[model samples]
Target: MRIRAVGTSALMIEVEDPLAWFAALDAARTDGRIDVTDIVPGARTVLLDGVPSVAALTAALRDWPPPAAASVTGDRLDIPVIFDGPDLAQVAAHVGRSPEGVVADLTGTAFRVAFGGFAPGFAYLTGLPWSIPRLESPRPRVPAGSVALAAEYAGIYPTASPGGWQLVGRTDAVLFDIDRTPPALLTPGRTVRFVIA
Candidate 1:
């Protein structure tokens, strides 16, 4: 792990495993070991905002033991999905499974929210056993609520927009709402599951 200053306040910690580090940092904050206002996690980094003293925090973090591999320590959400998509057969073929089998596998596995990007409320979920490839050509627009897979991540389109993922299903659950307190449904580190609708 490496900590770098990110202006007058805030420290960006680069780590091999972000979720584990995130859990550790959150614990520090909760236990009063660190004073910070926000803990923002990314794919490979965790940003500590509102730091009182960067120097002090840096020294403290260095002396602290490295975080262990994290289990799913966040809130769990079950999303109801309809497993019927244009690329469902393609995904099955790629994995050498029937469509029903594909759905079974997807629902059976628990996914973790690795990060949020590409669109508002669109979370890059990790935990697939196999990495799936992106479509060669980007689609003009993927419908809102489309559950798609790309690389090792599974994501839902919060709003209709152009996308390049392999669509495998969709959900009616609202992924983002400006009126909601936190907005994004799938914040980093949250455990997610897809259930047949």
Candidate 2:
């Protein structure tokens, strides 16, 4: 792990495993060990925003023990999905399985929100058994609530937008709502499971 200063008040910690670091940093902030305003997670980094003293945090981090393995300790949400997408058969073919088999495998896996990007409330989920490639040509628009997969991540489209991920299903769950206290439903560390609608 490497901690580097980002501007005046933020420190970006680059790690091989962002989830573990994120959980550790979040716990530190909650327990009053770190007076940080925000902990933003990325593909392989955790950005500590609004720190009062970067030097103090950096020194403390050096003395801290190695972070524990990250666990899905956040809210667990079961999303009801209709496993009938245009690319369902294609995904099955890529995995060398029937559509039903693919659905079974997906529903059986426990996914965790790694980070949020691409759009509001759109989370890049982790826990796929293997990596999958994106579509050669991205669709002009993917409807909201579309459950899709790309690379090593699974995600849901929070709004109708152009995307390249392979769509495998659709859901009715509200991923984002401005009125909601926590606008995004799949914040980092949350657990998600897809169930047949």
TM-score for all predictions? Answer: 0.91, 0.95
- Writing each residue's lDDT as its tens digit, candidate 2 over 1-197 gives 79999999999988888888889888888999789999999999899999999999999887877787888876789999999889989988988989999899999999999999899999999998668899999999999999999999999999999999999999999999999979999988889999999
Displacement of the residue 181 alpha carbon in candidate 2, Å: 2.3
Candidate 2 Cα outliers beyond 4 Å, as residue runs: none
> Could you tell me how far off, in angstroms, the CA of residue 64 lies in candidate 2 after the best superposition?
2.2
lDDT of each: 0.91, 0.92
Best by lDDT: 2
Candidate 1 stretches with Cα past 4 Å from truth are: none
Q: Tell me the lDDT of model 2 at 190.
A: 87
lDDT of 2 at 160: 99
